[model samples]
Target chain A: MTEPLFDRVALIGIGLIGSSLALNIRANGLARHIAVTTRRRETLEKAEALGLGDSYHLEATEAVADADFVILCVPVGVCGAITSEIAPHLKKGAIVSDVGSVKGAVIDQMRPHLPEGVDFVPAHPLAGTEQSGPESGFLELFRNRWCILTPPEGTDPAAIEKVEAFWRGCGSNVETMTAEHHDLVLAIVSHVPHLIAYNIVGTAADLETVTQSEVVKFSASGFRDFTRIAASDPTMWRDVFLTNRDAVLEMLARFSEDLASLQRAIRWGDGDTLFDLFTRTRAIRRNVIEAGQDTAKPNFGREPGNGEAAPGESTGS
Target chain B: MTEPLFDRVALIGIGLIGSSLALNIRANGLARHIAVTTRRRETLEKAEALGLGDSYHLEATEAVADADFVILCVPVGVCGAITSEIAPHLKKGAIVSDVGSVKGAVIDQMRPHLPEGVDFVPAHPLAGTEQSGPESGFLELFRNRWCILTPPEGTDPAAIEKVEAFWRGCGSNVETMTAEHHDLVLAIVSHVPHLIAYNIVGTAADLETVTQSEVVKFSASGFRDFTRIAASDPTMWRDVFLTNRDAVLEMLARFSEDLASLQRAIRWGDGDTLFDLFTRTRAIRRNVIEAGQDTAKPNFGREPGNGEAAPGESTGS
Candidate 1:
């Protein structure tokens, strides 16, 4: 067997990403020991029941004892507090990271509290399904998907490389960008898109002219597509918006301005404007397909009788 | 073999729906003969090459001659002129229908031009994919999907029943509603969703700060979901907006108002407000799943390794 990459790996907050990493670690022998910790006793017991970790701890400090690597897999809102809680317990030169969607806030909240010797290499896996909880993850979730690392400048290069190798072992293509760029990129690609989805679904759900039953009965197209993303973990999404507020707001303004013009075009019978925008947007879809970010299957490869395999992390983390 | 449902079936446009109907009719022995026609000689030649029809005609009048059933599988914008052109050639007592998304406009467009002895039933098969044309059609495109018929008041019940049976033969469950209600229902469910999807994709494409390549490379979640629908046929979608103007505008107003409030909530850090809407939308997804209108599998049953069959018609007609 290949030598283990680390003596121990500590995972705080054993949810979907955490559990999946636990599985990956065990399957690949990435760590000689796996320690899982969560605030809730019930969740810790559940992780223990699933045999997801070699050691389980209700206390974060206990979980991080002698650990050479620590990854926080909790909601972004708690990252600062959790980092403070685990800071002193981290072993010297231990690499620390996270799987939050918003990187700028995650870095701001996490890095300040991390101990001097520990390397804080912030990570954001652009991979997830609508489902949450520990049971929702699988080994293939990160396969052929992007896992972005936004390690602060002048941090340990060796630490960043090790984390990249670990993610690659979990079947992800590694990407590196600044925390600022990551937040900006994620705001347009994931955050604002999710906000609008949630908004449209709310609008459809509350309309007096259209009953919810009618909405459900005839949800054949675009509405149902939004619903999947809207159905993502509410708390996590709220944290996402709260953390990445400025970037999301900027993107939202742009989206609203564009939508207003489209609305005006419809009012004035400007079919050419609509047609031009529609045609131009298609080239981007082609680019995404060629970049292997999505499936070439029509309707996300979902509507076909003999369906193609859908691309991973369809909505967001 | 089972007795044919009709002596002859004429498909006035051999596009996705028409070719699929042709396959369904051939597979299930629903019609003795299929006559296909389109304005474009190239399209008719393509239909001929595929052997999709017993007879292919460049002239709509020739296709409708002696045909007991005629389906206008064309865009909503051209229904009126085409109906007037083919009016004199329609056989007496023949059932004529369409597969346009907007029923009220379609009825208003086509009914006045039809002959007295012919029955006009405006139908909408709530099905389609991003891909278009005759080549994209498949036998199971309408399987277990809804086909709503909006027959005008005082129309012949026998003709309506016959049209309903034809949709059933094509493996769709038929629903009947007034043209007005159908337009209203579709406005909230499909039309507005499509407008917003198209709008967002346009917005993302035109951003100066974020490059198009960045959008495509990081296109994993909500943005990618929209690119699929935004990638849908520009002409067909343009027609849908042009013909179904009022209802779409009404729904668009609701969506924008809700989005504005959501934008305010994000700006104000109203986590509870965001959380409540996010939680409420999940139930609609469950109801849509229970109604058999969509798949229960997470991410439209996509993102899973062994994916569930994604429900058909993920985007609008």
Candidate 2:
């Protein structure tokens, strides 16, 4: 067997991403020991029952004891609290990172609590499904996906490299950018999409003219895709919106303005404008397929690492 | 083999829905002969090359000649022209049906041209992928989806039943509703969703702050789903907006009001409002899942459907 990359890997908040990392660590033997911790005892029990780690603890301090690598996998709003709780217990030369969607806020909240001996590296995997919790994760979730790390200035390079290698072991391609850039990128890609989806679904739900049953019945026409994305974990998304308020608001403002223009076009019967915008968006979908982000399948498999392997994978197309 | 339901089946505008119906009719032997016609000669040639019909015609009159069942599958905007052109050629007892998204406009456009002995029925099969064109169709695309029929009052019940049976043969569950209600229902379910998806993708494309490359690179979080729907055929969707103008505008107004409230919530850091909306949307997703509208696999099998037969049959989830 290959030698373990680290003596101990502490995962603070054993949810979807955390448990997936645990599975990846065990599957690839990336760490000699795995420490799983969460704020809730029930979730911790679920993680332990799934045998997702070598050790489990309710307290962040208990979980981080002697850990060489620590990854924060909690909701972004909770990251600051977890960081403060675990800071004093971090081992010397430990590397601390996260899998939050909003890097700027994650860095802002988490960087202050980090001890001198530990490196606070903010990261987002650019991956997820609507499902959450420990049972919803798999080792292959990160395969062929992007993991972006946003380390602060003057952070240790060796620590960054080790974390990079660990993610690569889990089958991710790594990219480094500033936390601000990550927030801006995701605001357009992730946050705005989720917001619009949630907004539209909410709008449909509140419609007096059309019932919810009707929406569900006729959803195959295109509304259902938005519903699936809007169904993502409420707590996680709430935290994402709250923490990344500025970027999301900025993106939302732009989206609202654009939507208003579209509304006017529809009002005045401007089919040409509608067609032009619709045609331009097709190129983006093509680019996504080329990036290996969107598969060329007639129907894309949902849920991370489930059903069938991705097109880029060797098992099958 | 089952007895043919109609002596001749004429399909106008042989694109995705029409082509799929052609395949379904041939595979199931639902009609004794299929006559396919499209406005463009190139599309008619492609249909002929695919052996999609017993006879192919560029003129609507030729396609409808001697046909007992004539199904119009063109964009809603062009319904009137095709109906008026083929009116004199339609058989005395023929049933003229359409697969338009907006029923009231379709009825208004096509009804005046119908002969006394002919029945005009409007129906919408709530199914499709993002891909369009005649080549981007399969026999099973309508399997288990809803096919809504709107027959004007005093129309022959026999004609409606026959059309309903045809959809059932194509593997759809049929629902009957008034043309007015159908327009409103679709405004919320189908039209509004497409409008929002197109608007958001357009917003991202037009952004000065977030580059298109950045949007394409990180679309997986949620934006990509909107792009897939937004990538649907521009002409078809453009017609949907123009023909269903009033209902679409009404729904668009409701959506804007709700979006404004959501915008205010986000700006004010009202987490509870965001959380509640996010939570309510999950139930709609569950309803969609239970209704068998969403494809079962996560990511919609964008992987294996491109090549392999994935484990599950694709039910649009």
Q: Against the true structure, whose DockQ is highest?
A: 1
State interface RMSD in Å for all models.
6.3, 7.0
Query: Candidate 2, B221: how far from true, in Å?
Result: 1.5
What would the DockQ be for model 1? 0.46
Q: In candidate 1, what are the lDDT values of residues B82-190, reduced to their tens digit?
A: 9999999999989899999888888888888988999988898887777778998888788777789999999999999999999999887899999888888888878
In model 2, chain B matches the true chain B with a TM-score of 0.94
Docking class for model 1 is: acceptable
lDDT of 1 by residue, A1-317 (tens): 88888889999988888998898899888999999999899988888888999999999999998999999999999999999988888899899999998889889998888878888889988878777778776776776667899999998899999999999888778999998888888888888888888888888888888788888767765577887787888888999999999999999999999989998999999999999998998898898778776767766656443223221111100
DockQ of all predictions against the true structure, Cα-based? 0.46, 0.45
Q: What is the fraction of true interface contacts found in candidate 2?
A: 0.55
Native A-B interface contacts kept, per candidate: 0.54, 0.55
Model 2 lDDT per residue over B66-120, tens place? 9999999888899999899999999999999999888998899999999999988
Could you tell me the TM-score of candidate 2?
0.94
User: Which stretches of model 1 miss by more than 4 angstroms?
Assistant: A303-317, B303-317
TM-score of 1: 0.95
